[model samples]
Every structure is written in C-alpha cells, then in structure tokens.
Target: MEVNIRHARAGVTIAVDGLAELRELEWHDGHVRIGAGLNLTEIERRLDGRIPLMAEWFPQFASRLIRNSATLGGNIGTASPIGDSPPTLLALDASLILASREGEREVALADFFRGYRQTELRDGELIRAVKIPLPLAPITGFYKYAKRRFDDISSVAVGIALELESDNVRRIRIGLGGVAATPIRALKAEEALAGKPWTKRNVREAARVMGQEGTPLSDHRASADYRAAMLEQALLKFFFEKSEVVRG
Candidate 1:
C-alpha cells in the first residue's frame, strides 16, 4: 500500500500465501514453529493463550481488519522501530528461520535487525518461520501506550517475561519498542533484577535502569522523556499487577 500510494517502482512481488511449506505450523523439539505466512488473526486463534504475552498483545495490535491480512514475517521483515511484534517475540527469546535458494539458517531475533527499517534478511531470502522454545516464562505482560486505546500507533510498548524462584528473580526478559533505532531488549534492567529478591527497592532500581535502556526520540506521538518514563512505569505496573495476583 505504501508503494502504491507513493507510485513507487518495484522489481517484483512474490505472494507466498498459497505455499504449503510457508503455511505449516508445527510443534517439535520443545519449540513451536510458526509459519511465516500465517496471518496474525490465525496465529492468535491457533496459539490461544499458549504464549501468554502474545495473547495480551494481539488485541492491542492495529485491529481485527489489519491483523486479518498482516503476517508475522511481514511485520518482522519491515523492521519498523515501533512494530509491536518484535518486543513480544523478543521477550519470548524467539529466532527466525531464514531460507534462500542456497539453504536455511536460524538467527536470533535479537540479532536480526541491523538498523531502523533494516534487517539481516539477505537478498533472495525470506523468513520461513519463527521458532520459540518451550517451557515459557511463568509470568508475562504486554503493555502499549498510545494516544488512543485502539487502532493507534504506540508511543511506547513493552513486553516482559519472567521466572521466579520463591521471591527471587530466576530469569527475566524485557523487550521494548518505539524508543530506539530498533526494537531492543532491556538487558541492563534484566541484569539488575536477576538473582535478586523481587522487592520494591530492587524493582525500583531496575525500573530506573529500564527507563534509560534506549535512546528515545521525540516524535508526534510523545516526548522523549515521556517515552522513557513509560518504560519505567510499565515494569513497575507489571510488578504491582503480579503482586496483587499473588496476594489474592
């Protein structure tokens, strides 16, 4: 649509919707392989709540109409900085299977993007599938802050997955969008929280680190400071929500 609107020229466009290989969903080796051609709507229906973070995210995506036609491959391939899929998938510790005429290679989703709107997808290659390893993080959350509640681009988006040992953080992954040149993992925040008690003081410090994870830029949707503040707030919100769940 962007190409048509801009009257841009293209060499070729290949449609893979009918390709059986690109449309297969398989569960094997303790991981689910999501076919690249599967539409977002189908993915949501098929996965159900198996991937909790995605279940929380799907509705907040563009909308039913847009999701009907949007595929995961297309979403990730575009490498849009504000794209919602990247953060959720990143927190899941997913990988992409890239296929070319020569062969196939798997690349960690974290390492797939090189810059704004740039991906590691080589010429003559396409994302065959996304592989997410099993035994998912027990606690997960997805948050998108936008001007409107629905059908709006995010000002800041966050996806988080965590495993806890008693009250201590066993492992945690935080993925963020709309704050940098590419979707990124909150590694510093994760480091600060890992192996520590999930207490208010520790989380507060980690949240502060999260606020500084990406180089946020001011745009029409929000100010740079607001975006950073939201990053901090999102983590804090997740902790509170989980705490309430435990209390109840």
Candidate 2:
C-alpha cells in the first residue's frame, strides 16, 4: 500500500509481513498489465530498458532507488501535475483498464485525468492494465523543461508523436504537461500540423495557438511568458523531428 518516501521512512514497518500477499505483473500487446503491487525497480529489470524511449527517459527521473519501488500504476493512480508518463501516454493515445471486484472498464488517456491529483478512476477499483497504441511515427520528441535536467519535475513537458507522409504530417498527436491543471492534448496544434506543409511558419503558429490554448501559472520553476515561449519552440522542434519538409 506504500513506497518511496513513506516506505523509505517506515523501513521496518513496511514489509510483506505475511506470505499471503504477493503478485506478478501483466502485459499485453504494446502495453503492460500488472497487479497494483508492482514497483518501478521490478519493472526496470523486467523490461531491461529494452524500450529505448522509456529507458532514456528514466535517467532524467528523480531516483533510482525509488524507481526500484515506484510503480507506474501507482503513479498513474496518483495523477500528480508533474507526473512524467501521463503526458507521454496521453500523446500516444493510450487506453487503461480499470478493474474492481465488480468488473473492468476501459478509458482513454484523454478522459482518465480529470484534474490535478484526480482521475476518472473510481474508488475500490485499481488500474488493471495500460494499453498503448503502436507508434505511427518513426520520430518522436519528448521534452521535459525544468531548471535542472536531472531529477527535477518540469515547469513544462511536451510529448508529440507524428507520422510524416510525403513531406506533410499525415498523422499526429500532441500532449503537454506541467502547463495546465492536467496533462492535456494540444488538439489545435495537431490539426494545424496535419495534412499541411510541415514548415517552420506553420509550426510556430501552431505552437503559438497551443500556448494560447491554456492559461498556465507562474510557478517557481517558470513563468507564463517563459512557458509560452517554450511551447512555440517545442512546436518547431517537433516539426523538424517529424519531417524535413518546410511550409515555404
């Protein structure tokens, strides 16, 4: 029922006192399933960091020891503003299976998160599995912006997955975090990029609109002005990564 800071503090108090409590992880196509008891370290060794993206992103995370015990499912359930994977999974159009003693329900990533520290998940239910769509793009850009690169939660984090077709964005999904109450889609930005020439102009304008889409707070890590500026820049970077073509 606990891990990380609380577990580290409790030490002896937090133990599998009985033999009756133990479970294994579950996984399916392009996704993973697990009991609520799974932790981050077990996931790492289990996954062996084979998924290049997840592995690369791990180092930017706060703690290895915590990662050892911090379960992704738990984190998802917690739904913190700065939680890392929500934006990533949301951009990927991931689906989740929520289960209870009664039955199971599936919800889209976009709908799962309701607000800061809130999700659509009901009480007495646990996340059963995460279903991620296969990537349509060979190139993806995941950005986390904070004062320090390592172990710092971002003031703004952006995740975009794009599939380029004949120099245009044929398929696209955009996700943003730390700039809003919850990690959300930059749908306007996605529409702007789709089927159009993937040029810097379009990218800039789309990014501008994306920044305008949300009202971000001036937090300790960044200001509204700064976050807006970076969103624009994020658009441009994503564009270049997705396609070499330009709007000119």
Winning model by lDDT: 1
lDDT of 1 by residue, 65-176 (tens): 9999899998899899998999999999999999999999999999999999999999999999999989899899999999985799898999999888888899999999
- Residue 197, model 1: Cα distance from true site in angstroms: 0.5
- The per-residue C-alpha lDDT of model 1 at residue 233 equals 100
Could you tally the backbone clashes for each prediction?
Answer: 0, 3
Point out where model 1 deviates above 4 Å.
Answer: 4-6, 246-248
CA error at residue 122 for candidate 2, angstroms? 1.3
lDDT of 1 at 228: 95
Scored against the true structure, residue 47 in model 2 reaches a CA lDDT of 61
Q: Give the lDDT of residue 197 in candidate 1.
A: 94
lDDT scores of the candidates, listed in order: 0.92, 0.70
Off by over 4 Å in 2: 1-37, 41-52, 241-248
